[model samples]
Target: MGRHDFFSKYAPRPGRLRFAVSRVAVLALVIIVLGWIAISILIAPPPSNEPLATVPLESVPTSSQSAKGSASPSGPRVTVHVVGAVKKPGVYELPEGSRITDAVKSAGGLAEDAHPELVNLAAKLIDGQQIILPGDSTQSQNPNLPAPSNNAKISINTADAQTLQELPGIGPALAERIIDFRTENGPFSSVEELDAVSGIGPAMLEKLADLVVP
Candidate 1:
């Protein structure tokens, strides 16, 4: 075949040749559009079914934090010495509002010969307080005579004239004067108040300091 001979022999008209060329161009454009759509579908990301993340607005306290916040405060405590006719006598620690009876119980209760009626068991305990339980020996003794031992200090506010005379330098006249002073002025608040009495001087007070308590 020679150049341009095949188209001239098959079509024979210029109008037919132009119509075929337009039909071929339209089919090529349609194929290019379909290929472009397939390429976009393959490269694009897929749709997701998972939910988005979010933060809470308020926080809740943990177990330790809740326990700390709800905890109650404890009451105060006091330490005292329990002596004399209890089953076991020693220093003990107790709550602030504890009474003498409670201290006795803490010391294993009163001994067989202890005279519980002589002591006010309901009295409230204080820090550094000393409790002395009188026994059968003490109950049998006469109140006018001095105690066998000087280790126990006499209470000036509660002691009678005979008991007051048990202290050093205190005679019948001085004991009467101490009783008169306390009777006239009311109970002594402190041992130092004994100086207010006419006969008791600084030297006498110094000597009685360790032997008596107000």
Candidate 2:
């Protein structure tokens, strides 16, 4: 049968209320689906809190850290003597890594006319390194002056502690010890014997060979 013919023949009577009931049933199904969706959303737990990601801003230099963190815990402490044209001259205690300038500063700074050129200020101070401040007039010339050669010449055999301290790498304490050794043990048989003294060694003897005498 044609759709129009069928609908006309089976159309609900107004008093029967069949069309109204069918519309109400579809509306109920839509409301039920909406309610179920809303309940599912409200009843589910909120998503778990997540840990934050982090990154370091900077890292320390490995070389520098290792350098500062020395393998050995500590080392010997030594004192060096500073004398002559310095403002105040005397013995100064120093750690192994201290420098010549550090010792000079401890002795109260260089004299007004100290010869800075004669000594290496940056040299790493070894145990017993004496730093001397030379006289202002050392560079001058006068007939009354002793031979220029004499001024340049340093005699370890007869020179006092102050003079001996002027030698490279020799400090006032070592100079005094040398003098004492000379007094007690007799003049060094050869410059090499200086190593037999407590603080000196092959390296120091090499530095002193040119400056020492029989």
Candidate 3:
């Protein structure tokens, strides 16, 4: 082969060079578009949920409300008539587990003439129980009072507030004051010390002197 013919056969033409350059340009453009899409997916911000995440705070209960919620219900009650030598003789309604003494207390405790020894105070009381005092059921000169008897005197130092009310002209208020005085000043040494209690006049003291003992 001649030198010029060999050179023409081996070297590329302008048309083929133009076609290869066009293909390379199209491939580079596709690569750049794919790289941009990948970068956008990796670095884009997360979806917002501001309204969904927000919530209102709940209100807390107060101490009084909590106490009401935790409280247990009450039990059944009973009614009884306390007639006789009580301070306030009448009918009263009380809860279950009440005793005869409790019914007596509801009627303002026993009166001056009430004989505590005659009734069983520790006994349980039922509905509609009639609590008649020692001498109350009978007809007499002082039927509402205690039955007369030659009995031992009441002990002043050991007597409770209700027992103290048995003294002549003594009521619940005076009995409580006497108990308070006794607690503050110690036990009474003599009957004359009755005068030391508030609301106790000389006449009252003289009346109590013969009734109580230390």
Candidate 4:
């Protein structure tokens, strides 16, 4: 008999029906196992996100503002006169912590004949100080005068008109006025007393401190 005929013939029998039922059950179990495997593959967790890039909001630092708000003290500033043998011999305004070298640089550097050994370049400057550069021949003649003394100090109380002229912003006329004011008034109680004189104000006095005598 043909296979189709054989299967049809056996399809209605109790034993054949039992065998067909068992085969159907086996197919259903296999289908269920395959669906469960597909579901497990689809639902697996994705890879971690640890290596992504992040950006910052601030700008990089530069030389201009290396240290902001770290300014030096803001009290009175000293002014000094650097005359003779300097490139730009004039009055220079300096802070309290300035050195003789700083004043020389501000005066446009020393002249060719300026004896570098004469003055202590590292010496700290004071208010109302006068720094005179000697001539080449004079420096050679007087080696002692080159370096100021350890006790080298300015006497503001007794400075003459010529010495007072060495102050910054004080020309011959202003120098004369300073002397006259001191003569009329008693010895200055404070350096600020110079502002009491006519034509000499806070601005001018501030610039005169490093180079002034009395």
Candidate 5:
């Protein structure tokens, strides 16, 4: 067979050729769009099941709170009654471990007529204690009186502060306390009544048992 004849018989029609080429172009476009969508879905991250992270809240300390933390600690306190010769004699509150000197100062110190030498200022103070200062009246009246003899039994009711000081363990301060106690509560009925006096305890009473009389 001739070449031209073979070509003519095998070649497709123009209308059919155009239709086939359009169909192939449309199919290629659809495939390209579908491939792009699939690639985007695979490359993207998976959806998270956990909740979103939240910001934390911060607080600043207040002025009062800071002051409370920085303040110094305080110790226990004692209450006492001060009377006679001080500028302001009344009940007062003082810190624990305070001494007789501190109590006197708290009461505005000694008066002009106060005999400061008649008390033991260095003695430690106790709660609910009463301090009595010997005024000019008590001192001037018995300034020249002599202390009783060591072997004699002093009368607690009638003896002055100087005589009371002769007892064992009795200082000027304690002597004044004895005088004030008897003056306010009346003459003691028994030697045991000495226990009621401030600063006089069982030990002091025992020491004075043989040396003093009610």
Candidate 6:
């Protein structure tokens, strides 16, 4: 028999109607769920995956530390003379903040006969300061004159920075400069060469003329 004629002649089963209704309901529910998901995605998008910028603690310097580093002063050197019983008495270039002990070391340290009690080793050195050791009088031009004597005229070229300071108006700084000039350009040929040193003007040269020997 034909399907239309069979269906029309036979009564439909009660279970078939229920099965069709349940299938339709399930499909409608799935469609509704899918639409809801699509709407949510359109409303709220995913966040970007970029990282935040951050400086490491170790890389950053503290305010006090940076200030301390910048606070230090450099350069600005001064000259000082170490004389008397030092092993090698001479003029020495030193930092502006240097002390007498530092200048003494540069002059090759004190000799055994040095009178450590006379001079202040801990004192701060100045541009033209001299350290005269009491027992070092043997260095005087005339050994027979006695120790601690300055009566003999100092030889400009042969004298150390300390001895040169004996000249009028000549200090440790000027004495050092003179020695440095002498070392670089050989000994001063005559007292007239004193003019080459910046601080020694005509009047100073005249005063030093009778005192120093080339």
RMSD of each: 12.1, 12.3, 13.2, 12.5, 12.2, 9.9
Candidates in order have lDDT scores of 0.75, 0.67, 0.73, 0.65, 0.75, 0.70
Question: Residue pairs in steric clash, candidate 2?
Answer: 130-171
lDDT-better candidate, 2 vs 4: 2
Model 6 Cα shift for residue 74 (angstroms)? 2.7
Which 10-residue window of candidate 6 scores lowest in summed lDDT? 142-151
lDDT by residue (tens digit), candidate 2, 93-209 = 888777677878888888886655444466555455445545555335222212223224443444556767888888888888877776677544456778888789889888876
Candidate 4 vs candidate 6: the TM-score winner is: 6
Ranking by lDDT: 5, 1, 3, 6, 2, 4
Name the 10 consecutive residues with the lowest summed lDDT in model 1. 141-150
Give each model a TM-score. 0.37, 0.32, 0.37, 0.33, 0.40, 0.36
Which stretches of candidate 6 lie above 4 Å from their native place? 1-6, 9-58, 79-93, 97-101, 106-108, 115-214
**Residue 56 CA error for candidate 4 (Å)?**
29
For residues 42-98, write the lDDT of model 1, one tens digit per residue: 998997878877887786889999999899876898787876678999999998888
Q: 1-214 in candidate 3: lDDT tens per residue?
A: 9999999998999999999999999999999999999999999998886767658788788999999988988888888787767888899998887877898999998887676665557645556555665444431744433344456455555455677788898899998887777667765656778888889999998887667654
Worst 10 residues of 4 by lDDT: 144-153
- C-alpha lDDT of residue 183 in model 2: 61
Distance (Å) between predicted and true CA of 16, model 6? 4.3
Q: Per-residue error at 108 for model 5, in Å? A: 0.7
| Model 5 quality (TM-score) | 0.40
**Model 3 worst lDDT run, 10 consecutive residues:** 137-146
Model 2: per-residue Cα lDDT at residue 167: 84
Over 1-214, each residue of candidate 6 has an lDDT whose tens digit, in order, gives 8999988778667898799899999999999999999999999968878898787767666898899888968788887666667889888899987877788889888888765543446655656655554355544542422233244445455566676776789999998898788767765556788899979999999997666555
Residue 170 alpha-carbon offset, candidate 3, angstroms: 39
Work out candidate 6's RMSD over C-alphas. Answer: 9.9
Query: Between the candidate structures 1 and 6, which one is better when assessed by lDDT?
Result: 1
